[model samples]
Target: MSSSALDVQIKSLPNQPGVYQYFDSEEKILYVGKAKNIKKRVSSYFTKQHDYGKTKVLVKKIASIKHIVVNTETDALLLENNLIKKYQPRYNVLLKDDKSYPWICIKKERFPRVFSTRRVFKDGSEYFGPYTSMKTVKTLLELIKGLYQLRTCNYHLSEQKINSRKYKVCLEYHLGNCKGACEGLETEASYHKNIESIRDILKGNFKSSLQQFKTQMKNFAESMQFEDAQRIKEKIEVLENYQAKSTVVNPKISNVDVFSIVSDESYGYINFLQLAYGSIIRSHTLEIKKKLDETEEELLTLGVTEIRQRFNSQSKEVYLPIPLDLGENLKITIPKLGDKKHILDLSKRNAMYYRMDRLKQIKITDPDRHANRIMAQMKADLRLTEEPRHIECFDNSNIQGTNPVAACVVFKNGKPSKRDYRHFNIKTVEGPDDFASMEEVVYRRYKRLLDEEQNLPQLIIIDGGKGQLSSALKSLEVLNLRGKIAIIGIAKRLEELFYPDDPIPLYLDKKSETLKIIQQLRNEAHRFGIEHHRNRRSKGALQTELENIPGIGEQTIVELMKQFKSVKRISKATKTELTEVIGNSRAQKIINYYNKE
Candidate 1:
């Protein structure tokens, strides 16, 4: 919008609490937000410099202002939530769905019927949930039916109708599935009693149901009805088994809503725990894809609204690990001690697990996104000026100060680039002088790269302590390439990372992807270096055995060794086979040397 027109719109906005929406030039909603003063809150977007990149993008997209003034802040919060859920504005948390989860309904009738329904009718029926999944609803309903003989029929078994003999028994009664309240075979009193027990179970209170089952079992035992007693005993066991499965937390933590959130740059995972009479009645983790870099408070606030609305939660008390800005009608407790704290921590763990699973899914389904996130994270964690899209790690290896060698392993986008890996036979470094060996290899690697004008790695890692790093740095300095590329060294013992001038080492989180990638690079370089060293040592051993052969000069030995590959192969070669490569005289002499053994 033009500055004058925007100013006029802002001036007309009320100072009262309300929900404000930002629209783009195409009249598409960009964001939805609640505010005590619509003008001030909406104006802040254009007036202030937003530090978040997403917020800056949102501001640029917003071309018009729209708002609804409400009577109070609570109303504003509700309206903002509704608007976000409806339009799913670009900058708002938008995971909530209008389709409510399946709820197990026990319809209020002369003989109540239990079934799962997505649509709830307010006709005095008792509704158990808005469960997170249909599978949960099915499992719960199956457990309920297994414990109680409630009719699955939809027939309205009014008392007048039952007396009039208008309804007849169906296959359900013959199959022993239902008690047949429709046929008056089941007493209304007994049916109502079972309904009461179901109500207790739905409220997560199992004591009453278990006690009733025990009483029936005891009465049946006394009446010599062993089969009936066994049935009642089984019902007791089923009820207890279901209770044990559903009740994860303390029973005293009742009637509270628990929420926790874990987030990354792209998404937030918010887990909600519903507790009733000390057992967790329902638990769900919602994945919120962030359009902007929204704060945890904003995400949590949005989550609380969406979840409670979706599940029809009337919980007044909530437990959280961090403080939220939700207004005063609801009691939000930031738990710090005791069981509440433990439950809050559990919720946080659930959110973290969900986030982890989400990352895994992204890694499998969209590898490029996974690589990008890893690169960004590594750049931030290692404090590198640029993302290390091309990374190289160097390691030196030797056996008894003989056949010294160094290997450079390259990684592009956090994976090993085997084709780019190069092995260096240590030259100008006598014996096992690791520092000098490191300097020679690094100097040759980059000097050749510069000569060939090949792409250099953004970051270089030395797979040793400060000594190896400093040696590598000397080579960079001689080539006038010091500080041109980021360099660090990893010490094996403590996994300490050393920078050129820094005295203290940097320790990365052990589980971090950055640390894992560095470890992978280090291990690859070591493996490559060791393989080359071992081959060199083996060849040196083979050369020693061949060198002792009389009249076989080094040139003739080289030809035989090159053709045969190993001493055993040369020993296995026939005289004519050797002659074809090294001529008749040397071939006859090689045949004599191996045959003399």
Candidate 2:
């Protein structure tokens, strides 16, 4: 379709809450999204300039537009989720259908048997969860078993089978683990009562169960049944201990969903925490690859909808680090302090840890992907127009104005290229003038690279404040390479980064990866420069001292150094030892020089 035809379809969209789908020229769905006003949202795509390349591409490929108008935003969100799942649009966040998660199933029978399963059926049975891990499912099952006497076998306990004596009690019954519902030893009413308590326990409501157990223990003690009372006491303790371990905040905060997000340039990680009676019962972190550089709010909204639907959660309230409009049916609370803030922080930490672990795994398994992510992150963090794949950092080292020198360190793909490291002695500058030394080295390094037709670094770093950065920039200007390469300076006092022609410095977070890499480069350059300076100083000191000696030529000093290693060692050497290494006359001259000192 032409631009006119596309504009006509966008103009015809209604002004209401709905979902919209974008289709490419080949009639394939490219994206699915929801909006409060369909016309305004659709038109903004055409009017605004998008920074992300993918969003621009998506806009250009829009051959057609389709939409479904809804009465409210909640309906729109639901419809959008369904449409995305149905079509699996390329530009939408990927929401996995977690069919592999474990669930606790209560079978639809006369006496229900509870067990964990990976599959769900539409047989009218109750399934409690689709937990994130098998360990959590197992722990829940064990807790229920320790507190209640429930059947674990698959035997059908129909009235006809029980009346005909078709089944016998299993070993579980003799072990005091089951109530023998198969053999009719446990009444149906009593068994259903235990089932009700188990259901409540699974819902993370332990109050009723604890009350009932305390009452039973009190009755057993009154009847002088010491063993039964002791068993009941043990069960109570077990339940209490489990609850204490699970609860993270005040028990008054119940049946709410907590969500927090951590994002980078390419993906967003959202962590969901399902709380019941102030205990965290469910946790899941979703990784969403960004197709259009989506913001945290957009990803969080979509993530909450998808996660809640997948887990079959009917939570009326939610806690978030940021406030969002998720329809009027759900109450969204942004926690500022107290227990709510603590839980939100916990969720945020979970998201951060998940992101860290995922990046570490990707670094080992797919290094290219990891490098791309770091480059993109650095580009954004430094506000560069392009990724700094090749970078060079320059540092000047001079102690008390004595052997002034500069070092250049190269980094390719955010790692040090040790083979590309170079050192320079400041020949044009007189004293420890850092600015002059920096200007001289920067000019020489790039002049040589340009002369030899070698590849130039995308970025240049100066290990000083604004003064050194300006000095480096002047070289770029003289070489007619100004504005062709990015240059910045790092101050050693506070790790502040100075950009060319910018007075205000960029202060990255102390723990940010970009800052760490910049610091690494600065430190490496400083160390390299200091090492070269120390070597030059020591060599210069040795030459000046020995060259001043009378009748001590270069060859004689070389012969003595070959044997004694240093001037101090040669001076300390015995006459016989010196004669063996060098000639006797030169050896005596070296000994006389040191003896006068």
Candidate 3:
């Protein structure tokens, strides 16, 4: 289809909420999106200038549009998520997780066997979970095993087989792990009771099991069965201990799915915490690779739908850091404080930690990808037009108006380039005027780079507040480089970042990698500047001391320094040693001066 035909199709789209699919010339699905107003949203795709390259590519490849109108935004979101998953659109967020999570299955046969499996089949069996890890599955199964003596063997346990004595007890029955269900030693009613308790336990509701155990222990105690009572008490302790460890919030806040998202430029990590009876039963983090620079709400909405569907969750309420429309059937709660907020924060922390661990692993396994992610994150966080591949930071260093100097530290690909680091002595600016020194240093650094046609930095960080930033901007304007190069000022006290013509400073998350890089640059520049200033002060002191001597001159001191590496070595030198470098008269003058000191 031509652009004119595509436009006509978009124009024919309804104004109601719906899911829209974009198809390429080859009839392959390019993207899937949800919109409250189908026609307006599809039209905006052509009218607006997209910032992301993939979005622009997607728009260009869109040869035709197809949409399904829905009654509400929630329905649109659900429909869009399903279509994206079905078609696996190229420009839609990828929601596939290939890991086969473990699930605790209660077999559907007589005297059901409870065990962990990686696969789930529709055999009328009760499948508890697709847990995030095998360890969690093992732990839950162990707890259930300890609490109930359920059968582990797979036997038909038909009434005729048991009556005919066709099956016998196994090692599990002998070890007290099973109650000989195959031999009909355990009644169906008793076995089902234990299975019901296990079901409640898997759902994070241990009240019924605990109450039953307490009642059995009381009966055993009343019958003078102290050993049995002791065993029941131990089981109770174990159950309570596991419950305490799993419970993260108030017990009243139950049976809801909590989701929180932490996103970077390239990916979004949404953590889902399934809570039941105030305990976290399931925790999973879903990672979605962003294709069109989707917003947090969009990512969270899709992630919630996908994860809930994948886990077969029937949760009617969800707690999120931000409000979202997820159909009229699901209630969205944004917690502000107390236990609800704490759980929400916990979900966010899980997502954040998952993201950090992934980045760390990628850094070691794929350094290029790690660097790209950092660069992309920095570009987004700093709101730069391009990734800051090459950055320079300037810092002024002086002590009580002495030896005023500035240093410029270069960072390439988010790492310090030691060879490119430069230091400047404050020649044009006499006193310890930081702003003037910044202006002078900025002018000289870029002016020299321009003269030699060296590549300019993508960003310049001024290690001070607004005053230093304005000063650097003046130099950039003088060199006709203002607005061409991105520049920001970092205040030392608060680590606030100030941009040109923006009074309100931007405060990045203290733990953000971008802020860490900027802080690293600032600290490196400060250290570099201080080292240079200290050297200049020492050199000036040496000159001042030598000038005090009536006969000593700059040339004589220079010749003496040529023999002795430092003033301390010169002071310790013998007169004969000094005479070999300078003349006898100058050596005597140096010796006399040192002797007097």
Cα deviation at 53, candidate 1, in Å, is: 3.0
Q: Residue-wise lDDT of candidate 2 within 453-506, one digit each (tens)?
A: 999999998999999999998899999999999999999999899998788999
Write candidate 3's Cα lDDT for 1-597 as tens digits: 988888789888998998888888999888888888889988998999897798888888888888898888877876877787788887888867454888999999878888998888988998988888888988998899899998866778898999899998999888998888788898999999998999999999989999999999999999999999999999999999999999989888788999999998899999999999999999999999988889998899899988988888988899988888787788889899999999999999999999999999999999998889999999989999999999999999888899898899999999999999999988988777888989999999999999999999999999999999999999999999999999999998999999999999999999999999999999999899889989899889888867788798888877877778788898889999988888798889878988999
lDDT of 1 by residue, 135-204 (tens): 8777778878888887877787888898899999888788777987876888989988889988888888
How far in Å is the alpha carbon of 346 misplaced in model 3?
Answer: 2.3
TM-score of each: 0.89, 0.94, 0.88
Evaluated at residue 322, the lDDT of candidate 3 is 83
Backbone clashes, candidate 3: 0
Model 1: runs farther than 4 Å from truth?
4-16, 36-51, 71-74, 93-100, 121-124, 221-227, 477-484, 547-585, 594-597
- Candidate 2 wrong stretches, greater than 4 Å: 545-565, 573-597
Q: lDDT for each of the candidates?
A: 0.87, 0.91, 0.90
- Give the TM-score comparing model 2 with the true structure, all chains together: 0.94
Candidate 1 weakest ten by summed lDDT: 92-101
lDDT of the structure predicted as candidate 3: 0.90
